[model samples]
Each structure stands twice: as structure tokens, then as C-alpha cells.
Target: MNKISESGVIGVDVHTIKSWIDQDDVVLVDVRETSEYDKEHIPGAMLLPMSKFDAEIFPKVLGKKVVLHCAVGKRSESAGKMLIDEGYLETVHMIGGIEAWKASGFATEVQITPPPSPSELKNQEPQFLCPTPGEVLRDEYMTPLSISNAELAGCIGVTEKDIEQLTQGESKVDVVLSLRLARYFSTAADFWVHLQIERDLEEARHEIGHTIREEISPRATASN
Candidate 1:
């Protein structure tokens, strides 16, 4: 199949594009003015203003499959056509724009925040960061069901000393502890397992914070 084609384009509704936001492989570009974007746009969309389509924006997106959108369908259609002509592998325009998106029961919000930087993209991670230090302590020490440290330690066949040491950052996480904890708590087995495998909870906590602030916050915005 010809990778680059204008006539064979597919137009997706806003709701469909919204559902694809969490897919790591998809890239959604909004071909609207900065002002329009600030007022309201899809969460996680990267803006490549229609007025500024040039070598700078064109080259980076050349070989990738792109989904282009605007406030209505007009600008996105224009942008997609231009991108196909510029040798983009595939360019699909959003059919109904933001209004059609909202009409389908997908959420919308005015994005007061600026777009993420390239450096930000390079450092992105995942959720499980927003919990308080006390919560982290609880996750480590307290029983998952009862929220009592003593109870949890007993169920896991570990002394309170073990739980205390883990919570106090004194003991390095171990696979044995992780397995026992997973069975006892029935929470995120991989997270506990990862603590042992990676041998670094501080680093993991720090990374989780970045994800919470960047990627997770956008979803919160959409819901509001």
C-alpha cells in the first residue's frame, strides 16, 4: 500500500481520538491557533498551528502516522492534505472537530497549561505518584485490607521490625519480602516485585511523581 496518500484518507470522530490518547504509539496533532488551543482542546494533543506549517514541523512528522484535528473539521482536513503532500506516511483528519467530540459524551476542558517540552517527553513515566508520604508508608507497612501495620506484618510472616525497616528506608527491598507482601496484601504485585528487582524505591517514587504531574493531570483536566 502507498504509505502517503491524500485521497484514501480516513476521518475519525473526536470521541474515537479521545479513546486513543493512552496508546503510546498514537500521535494526535491539533492544527489550530495557540489561542484556540488554550481555550479548549483534546488532552495530550500537540499543537502544530496551521499557519506555521513549514520545514520545521513538516520534517519531524514526515514518516509517522498522524491524526490531525481542529476546532471544526475544516483546518484539520487542510492540514492533513498538506501533510500528505509533504510525504507523511499517513495523515487522518478528525471528522467533527471538538464539538462533535463533546457531543459523543467525551469530556472537554479549557487547557490553561502549556504543552510539554521535548525534554519532558523523553522523561515521561506512569501514575501511582500522587499518594502522600504517609500513604507510601501505609502501602509499605500497613495491611492492605485492614490498614494496620502489626496485622500486615503477621500475615506476611515478618516481624514489625521488617515492616518498620522497610518503611523507614533502612532495609533494601527483597524478592522474598516482595512475594510474601504480594500474597499478604493482594495489591500491586509487580510494584512490590519491582521494588525488589530495581532495588530503588526512591528513584521509583521520583519517577512516579513526574508521570502524575504530566500525563495523569491531563486526565483530571478532561474530567473537570
Candidate 2:
């Protein structure tokens, strides 16, 4: 099968992707909406919907190549750009997505299982990086439930801007918001607060360690 290229994105045929799948040498990602992904997708593909695609939060391919796709090729192309922009050296988008794959006599996987119960979610660590509370809210809850900003605000009794700001990371997750999110998403309020605390600590460590290390260096004392 022939490979196509456009706008810095590499498009490979379904057959080529299938070869990688058989070899298990590539990380396949589905970049469609949650509802669409819950309908059907390529087997072994992890769902990372485009609406909440955070390059920093995305799982790395490690030693393998990364392949992305949606219902068609367009969204995957965009996802490819995001990955490339974020320093992914080897990335490919499935040309024509599952549609072309099925048309070419390849099989697709249908999602028949419901989401795990809250008890099941307990004790499981997040699969991606330490994401912000807003990112978790957007991807895990709001997107999955198809809740619009206005709808969520109405249900939770907050302004739409409040919800928007939280999701955009422009505002911090406070006790009230945490309570609302916890109630709506079936998670603990501390889950939301701890996500913010962890992110803050990570940032502080990066900057604080550099400054303190330079000031306290043994070489500085020796020179003095």
C-alpha cells in the first residue's frame, strides 16, 4: 500500500498499520469523541479524544512508533500535527481510519462493555502523566457525559465561565468546585484538590531545585 504525506503529517495505509499491530511495535491511539469511540474502534487502540488531547498528558510511545486515527483521516492528521509539534519524532496517522480499514476487509472492535464501577476505579492510577484537575474534569467526566458548559453550569449551579475557566486551567479548583466535580463524577473531593497540589509541587520543584542548588553548591563555598 502507498503512503501519503500532507502538512507534515504522514499517512499510512490500513494495511501498513495492520502490520504494525500484528507486530505490536506501534502505539495506536484513537482521537475521536468518547461517544464515537464507545461505538467502534480499532482493536488495541487507546482512546484519547481530540477534544481533550493534551500532548503533555499523552502517554509516550517509549521505543515504539505512535499511530493515531479517528473515524476518518482528518482528525488523525490534526492529532499527528499536535504530536509532532510536541516533539514526537516518529508519528503516523491511519489513512481513511477505520472506514478504510473495514473496507479493505480488516476487522474493527466494537465497545460493548460499560464503564467500570466506582469501586473498580478505586486504587487505579491515572494512565497518563500527572494531569491538571481541569484536564481530568474535561476528559474523564464532561466529555464522556457529553455535558455542555452551560448544561454543566446549570446542573451544578455555577456560571459557564467558571466551568470554562476551570477546564482551561485559567482558574484553580477550589473546595466548592471540587465538591461539585466529585459529586458529578463520582470521585472524592480530595481527588480534584490533590491533582492541583501535585501539579503545583511539580512546578515548584523544577524551579526551586535549580535556584537552591546553585546557591548551596560546594563549589560556591570553596570559591568564597
Best by lDDT: 2
Q: Candidate 1 lDDT, tens digit per residue, 1-224?
A: 12222344467766556656655546788776676677777777788765565523564644345688776555566556555556763567777666577778776667466767999977766322122222344542353334565766777798888777776666755667766765653433433544343334445656576776676644345455
Per-model TM-score versus the true fold: 0.42, 0.49
Candidate 2: minimum summed lDDT over ten consecutive residues — where?
Answer: 123-132
Clashes per model (N, Cα, C within 3 A): 0, 0
Q: Model 1 clash pairs?
A: none
Model 2, backbone clash pairs (residues 3+ apart or across chains), number: 0
Tell me the deviation in Å of residue 78 in model 2: 0.4
lDDT of each: 0.58, 0.74
Off by over 4 Å in 1: 1-8, 55-64, 111-224
